[model samples]
Structure formats: C-alpha cells, structure tokens
Target: MQSFAKPRALEPLRPLAVHLPSMSYVDVKMRWKKDASFDAVPVLSRARDLRPLVSLARLLSPSPTPVSVVSKLRSSLETPDRRVTSFLRRFPAAFVESVGPEHNLPWFRLPDAAVHLLREERDVFAAGRADVTGRLRRLVLMCPRRRLPLRVAQGMLWHLGIPEDYFKDPDHDIAQDGFRILTSGDGVTCQDDDGRELGLIGDGKGKEMPLSVLQLNAMRKFGSVAKVPVPLFQSKGLRLKRKIQDWLEGFQRLPYVSPYEDFSHINPGSDVSDKRAVGVLHELLSLFVTCSAERRRLLCLRKHLGLPQKFHLVFERHPHVFYLLLKEKTCYVVLKEAYMAGGDTAIEEHPMLKVRKKYIELMEQSQEIIRCRRNRKPIELQSMVSCSGDIEDCTEILS
Candidate 1:
C-alpha cells in the first residue's frame, strides 16, 4: 500500500482588500429620474391605493361589517375612518352599503361580483400553495443562516401571493420540504435544513447556475452573458449626463456576481460590491409574485442580506433595471421587466393579477356611478344602485 504524504496545515481565509483610484471614493448624490411609461404601469400605480380596499373587503368577507367595526381598524389600515369611508364610497361596484340588522348602523358588504371574485382568489391561493412556499424558501435561503424571521415573512405574504391564513394553519404544507418553524422566547423563525446550497432559481447541481432577470436579458440581447446589459430608457427624451453615464458604464463593466453565490469575498464599497448589491435587490424583487415591493418594506431586509446602509440608492443608480414611483407619499420600487417588453405577462401571469384585473373592471363601474350621480338623474341612479344589490338603502346615501 502506498503511503500518503502529510498534508500542509490549512490556512484561515482572510478578507480580500481591493484598492482603486481615489476618484472612486467620491460621494455623489444621484438624483432620482422619473419615467412616465413605468409610472403608467397599471399594477404599480393602483396597487398602493387598492390595498386598503382589499384589506377591508377581506374583513367584510365573512359578513356585513358595520362602520364602527371598520372604524376600529384605524390602526391596522393606518388611516382614519373618514378616509376609509371615503375610499369605500368611491368603489360602489365592489362594496355595497347596507344597514346593520341589529344596530341599524351603516354596514358594508361585498357585491355579488366581488364575492365571486374573492372566492376565485381563495381558490387560486390554495392551488398555488406550493409556489408560495417555494418563494418563501428561496427568501430564507438568501439569508445568512438559512433562516428568516416570522414577522418578515408575514410582511411579505401579500407580495408573495400567500393567504393570510397560511401562518395560522398549523397543518400548512410549509413544513413539508426541509423547512421548519422554530419558536423560542425571542420570537418565531423559519429555517431550512443546513448544508443545502440552493440557487436563486435552481439547484446548484444543474449545468447552468440560476441567472438573474438581468443576466437572462443580457444573454438574450448580446448572445452571451455580458457583464452589463444595455439599459432601456423608458422615455425618449430622458438622458443621463456625461459624468453619470460614464460612471454607470464603468460600474456595469464590473464582474457580475449571482446573489446566491458567496459574497464574503467582495470588498466593501468597491464596484464589485455594488454589483453584488444590485444582484441581491434584483433577486429579492424577482421572488415576489408581483416583481415589485415598497421601498420601506425592503429596508427590513438590509441587515439580513449584508447590504450597505444606503442600499436603496441602487434603485436610483440603476434606472434601467429598477423604477421608483412616488405615489401617495410612499416610494414603490418596481422591477421594469415585469411591466415592460412582455416580461412577467409574457411568461406566466400570476393568478392574483387576474383577480386584480377583475377588480379594476369592477372599479371602472364607479366612474359611471359618479357620472350618473353628478347628473342628479334619479332614474339612472336607481337603476345603478339596484344593480349594486342594495338599491333601497344605498339610494338615500347616494342622493
């Protein structure tokens, strides 16, 4: 038998120190640029305002709810009763006003069309349980310890297309695939089994590592995996200044790093590090069913993802990939691919989107209702209110 030579002592890995020219350290405030096409994207534009309506609809799903009961939800909805009531009245097609049987107070209930649509939404959630869990799993895998706090996951339920009952149901299927929920004195956490090296979109065993939306787009356009994809400006007149454009071009030329890969080797504040940061944001947004998220919501993820203090600036720096929409005094970061060039819609539309479109159709009826009401035509108003299923009661309110 051949004797094996003694192996040399293993050395501890050290962090790499990257050095660059002094100019790279200059601090520049990147001004936010607006894009009309992205602002006009239907889903991103309306989802914020519709969220309150949807939440109230779900609350009233079980039975007609009184204004007093809805008013108590001020803290939950983050808006006062007046605002909530105003919003409810704006959508006559989706919500019907009635008097409570017991208290005779103003009550709200879903219209028949809204009820049927909500039922279909539930069916969609049930059928897509596996997909929702998969998205959650991917999110946890991106964490440093393959663990994610329960509160964070809960916050993401709406964007992930998960039903509100998911966590409350102990028998839910989330515990099926190498995932478990651990409870302790601190709080609840969702963790995956150790030693599993899952990629963003695929397992590492595959020949091709999972590529981000940007990478795939680059490959398609360049016929190879280019480090930087050609940026698509939303507006014809919009243009980047020479200095900023040059800096962006230089930043784009940096080597691309996958979000799922090891990031410890990257140097902080370097161009490579910025690329990794961008990759992380891209992957995180891609996991969402809507491919968009509120900027404030994403701040909760920074510490867990090893992102810089000002990671949000990436959205401003990379307008081609991300779009920042300032609406209702809240900033929403939208992944452009989802709305442009037949991205998410071209591949497969999320079931929630179908429900949303139906809700939009229902909302359109409100315009007609308002038009009829403005004309002070009792005949048309009566006919419309009758169609709402509570003509006798709502007619007085509408008038």
Candidate 2:
C-alpha cells in the first residue's frame, strides 16, 4: 500500500524507543500527503473509530457461530489494524466475545438488541434502495473517472443510503457487465491528449463501448471549472471588492487552463498563477462540500486535479472562506457558510441525514440493550433515539 497521511496525528508524543504501541503499526494512512499540518492536527477520540467497528459488527452479525472477527474483517474493512482486538474490547456491551469452537481463537458476535437495529437497518434499506441507487448512479456519472473505489462507496454508505450488500448484488454493482460500466479496479485505460487516463471504455468482457456525443459534452463541461467569487458581505472595504472583481475578471480573460494539463513549465510560486490555482481548488471544493465538510488534504483530487503536496496551504491562506478543523488527525475543510448554529452541516434535510439519524438510533439501541442485560431491568431508549422529523415525530411515537 502507498504511504499517505493519517486523518489524525499521534498525540502527547509517544516515544518510539521505550515501547511500541500495538495500534501504532496499523495502516491508518489516508491516500493523501503525510506531512504534519501548519496548524495542530487533532486526534480523533477512541469513540470516533469505534463507530466503523459497530457497522462492521452489524455486517458480521448474521453468522450463527462466533467467527473470528479479524479474519472476517480483512475483506469487509478498509484497513484491519492490529488494534482490532483492543478496539473490540472497548465495546463489550456492543459485541460479545467467545472462543471459536473450530479455530480455538477469539470471536465476536452482536447481541440481540444490536441485531434488532440491524433488522431495522434492513427495513430502511429495503425502503430506500431506489433513492440510494439513484444517488449512486448520479455520483458515478459525476465522477471524472466514471468509476469510484469500492472502499469509497462503503465509506459513504450511511450518507449514500447504499446497502452493505450492494457489491454482492449484481444489479446494484456500478460496474455490471451488461451496463457497459468499467469497475475502477480493472487495469483499463483511455488515453487523453496528454496520455492521462480520462475515460472508461467498458468492462473487458465484450467490445469497447464508445462514448456518446452527450457524454463527450459532459466531459468537456466537467473540465470547464468555474471561478470562485470573493465574499462581498465580509469585505467591508468597497475598494477591496472592486479590486477582487477586477482581478477575477482579468484572471478569467486568460486562456482556460485544464488541471490535467502540464503545469511543470509554469512557476508554481508565481503570485498570479498561484492565485489562479487557489481559485481552482476553491471552486473544486465547493462542488463536494454541498452536503458536509470535505477533507482539506483532498487525496481524491491529488491525481485528478493535479494538486501539489502543499495544496492544503491554499485553504489555510484563505481562512475566511475555508474553516479547517484539524479533527481526527485529518483537516476537515468546511465552507464557512455551510454550517448552522449548532455546528451541524446544512444539507437541507436530505434523506442521507435521516439515515444517519437511524445510525444514531442504532447506537442508542445497542447501549440500551447492554444496560438492560447488565442491570436486569427494562432500559428506555425513547429519549436517546433521534429522528430527522421529516418522516415522523420520534419523541411522541417512542414515548
């Protein structure tokens, strides 16, 4: 695997000599730069990492026997760290541990209440498959590469409302052979003018499907990036706004520069060119930050947008427009205007938000189950569970 930066950084500065931490050897790297940020990067609390494990546990809950969680997780999880057992141990209430009868190794299984949440999740999935598929189809179409990594799809499962079983379902896989879709993993290439991979031909099973005129038009439009406008309200100085407008207008008059085009000839440090590059990045980020925050390091764009190692510095320079939260050792670059009063993202009451509310409910249900099992008394989770208020009143119904 290629080396990339971890979303979170090591905290309190652990010594490398005294003793190596168990989790330290894990592949926590993201597909982005590894350098420490100019600003302090925050470490994610243990709870944050545990959430992924919860989803993983649910995926594995159907097994009749307590299967070795590590062996099963290798395929399911992006990175099965050495700290897997340690992380699982942290959540005894959520997952039950036992020795595998056949393998004589430790195994984990979800409790009954957690399974109930899983059942509810399945119901939600059944109800939302059409919407999720539509969203996924649109996402695939929007991708400059026309294919996304399976790992990325899995990571966005909650927000996308994509079922965990999507890959298993031939109808749902984005790269179904009959659909003339090429999966990202396939070593196929479409040579652009600069010899960069730009388009997908199809699955290797049959004759290459040619791109339509409309599809070609879409590709052209995708390359045509818009300019970022300066915030007029924030600029108290009228002269400043006028200066920005003039600068932007002048910048627009220059020949359109495709990000994929070679920038090696251009001096990267030149203020005029650098300013243009910054605006390009801002415009690119605006497209994705429509729902929530995006990673400041932007690993996904590194190759696609031809960004440099220190590209994050651009967002850092424009602090007013981009708020960089050094959370989870990764910089979450959020648009300043996208946030509401309570720090929640402004997604306009999207269905994805509603799905996430169910996730919150799952966590609550799991906790309540643990509480009841331990205390031997009924544990009420009505107050703990949340609803997006789009469907129904969770408080009244649950109460």
Candidate 3:
C-alpha cells in the first residue's frame, strides 16, 4: 500500500501577492544520490507522484532498531543528503481514475517504484537512468495521434519530474517522440490520443498557439474575435500550419504593447509623401509578395501605435490586414478590401497596386521612376478637397 506522509506539517496555504508561473504549482520531486561518498545530492524532476518517492521516504524514518527486514528497508532508503525540496507529489484524481482498474502500476505507482529503486543504491539508479530513453520510446508507441503543443508536453514532463536533461536534450529522442505522439496535427483535424489533450491546440487555425497564450491570458476571446482567416493557396483542404507559415513569409510581427510604436518618427506637418511615409513605402516595396502573416503584423503594429484598425480582404471573406499600397506613401490606414478585385480593369495592364520591383526601384532610384510613381498615386495629383459645384458655378465671362 502507498500513502503520502503527513502533508499537514507543510505550511498552510496563504494568498501570494506575487504572480507565479503555472509550472511552479507542481511539487518538486527530489531524490538523493545513491552514492554515499557524495555529501549531498538532489535530483530535481517533475514526475513526482509517478516516482517511488513516498515509498522510499517511509523507509528512511527515524526508527533504526527494527527487525532485520526493516533494517534492510532503512539501508535501501537512507541517503547522505539532508537538503530536500518541501513539496509532496500527489497523483491527480483523473489519472487515478483512468488506470486504476486496468494496471496496478498506474496512478504513479510506477513512478514511485522508480524512485524507490533509485534510493536503493547508486548502481541501481544509474542503470534505470540509461534505460529511461528506451522505456519512454516504448511509451511513445502507444502515443495518441492528436497534435498537441510542446508547452503541454513540457508541463507534463515537469509535473512528472522526467528530468531536465531528458526533455531539454535535443539528442533525447524519447521526449521528442513523446511530444510528437502526444501533439501531432493541425488544430482542426486531430484525434485526441487520450482524453487529456485539452487546452493544447491553437484557435482551430494554423500554428498551434493556445489562444490564452495569444491574449497573454488578459482576455479569453481577443485572438478568436480577431482571427482573419485567409486562403493560403489552391491546394486541397488547406493545411493550417502551412497556411500560417506562408502568411508569415512576408511581414515581421511587432510586440503587442502600445509603447513599442514610435509615432514621433512621422513628420506630421510635411506633405503626404514625407520621409517617414516614404520609408514605410520603401518597406512595402521591399516585400517580395503579399503574405498574410506580415499583414497581421501590420495590423498589430498599427494597434500598438494607436493607429486605426486595418484589415484587407485578399479573396472573398478572407480579409488580411495591411498598409494600403495604392499611395506612394505607406498609408497608416489599413486596406479593408480585397487586393485583387476580379474585374476587366484588374487586367494584366492597369493594376491597383504597383507590384513590380523594377518600377519601384526606378521611382526610388531615378527621375523617370519618380514621375511614374507620382503619376500612379491618385491623391498626389488629385485634390481631395475639391468643390465640384463651385467649379461649374463660375459665371461665364471669358469670350
């Protein structure tokens, strides 16, 4: 039978004014090194309830003058190390319910057994450490096909005390395989391996970023409310991951904070085609092609700078946010319409936005290109505030 020692001895829970990461919630399972020569040793791991910690601790009780069998037990559990973390590792009820009926080894018994063996002596623990990868690999064979975020898997590793080197190690294929087995697909199309794959996938779009992560846990619905789904390509049943990667191909994302924006850089008093605007235009010119990721970043930057919200639809209903490229200057305003409207004028000749790098270079590099660029912008040549009736109302006096 297994049981946790008197947990009441631990300090009573008090409200901590400070915020702590969720990982800190789990118990710190530490095992003393088997080697007696070492003055003290502490092995930090998250796999707490799963290891043999409780069983071994019980054996190390102050009672020394017991039967020969109890002496053997003490010999097995005694450690040279006095320093230990002060947290009890307990199995979650959910895990307890899941495997209680099927395996006697479930509900952290295996983990406990492993910890007990570790404290038995140095050699035994060393052997188990070497076999850890193969054992984890076998566990992977039974992994669920559902794709989960690395965060959840990492959290599991920490809670389980799998070992820092195991999960941190790129060479440790077990943890990598475990990650793949656990979290393995687009948010939309995945079969949950176990019932525990909750709060893992992103907003059923591309890139498995948990929505809570997106809003920084400030609001529940910010990312979903703002998701502008874009058509990636003509491929069959577009993949969310591929689509997100394709979207990020063009633009870079700025931080979400408002202070990150520098509006002072804009020459507010100058002509529309001032240096700052020109610089923004040049950045637009530098883009090899239109992409959704960059478009999202453009919107985010605008919001960060307290600029107006801009979302452009590339296709029907597939809106992307971007700086309107119609003007030679990069408009602080976002284009809220489709880039290419399928019309006769949207032919191979007259275009809404100039896409040619050579032409933009000509405008930026020489006088001819500058003339072409200036002519292309309607606002540059056309008066935005023209009074139409006043022009026609002129009393005819010229013969």
Question: Which numbered prediction scores highest in lDDT against the true structure?
Answer: 1
Ranking by TM-score: 1, 2, 3
Candidate 3: C-alpha RMSD after superposition = 36.1
lDDT for model 3 comes to 0.27
**Models sorted by lDDT, best on top:** 1, 2, 3
Residue 157 local lDDT, model 3: 34
Q: Which runs of model 3 end up more than 4 angstroms from their true locations? A: 1-126, 129-131, 146-148, 158-161, 170-399
**All candidates: TM-score:** 0.77, 0.50, 0.16
Tell me the alpha-carbon RMSD of every candidate.
9.9, 17.2, 36.1
**Model 1 regions lying over 4 Å from their true place:** 1-30, 79-83, 101-104, 185-210, 218-234, 343-348, 378-399
In terms of lDDT, the poorest run of 10 residues in model 3 is 38-47
lDDT of 2 by residue, 79-179 (tens): 33555665555455456777877857777877654565556556665665555454544444334455445455445444355566565567554443222
Candidate 1's displacement at residue 175, Å, is 1.4
List model 1 lDDT by residue over 90-137, tens digit each.
887788888878867778888776777677778777787666666667
lDDT of 3 at 394: 21
- Model 1 gets an lDDT of 0.66
Candidate 2: 10-residue stretch with minimal lDDT: 22-31
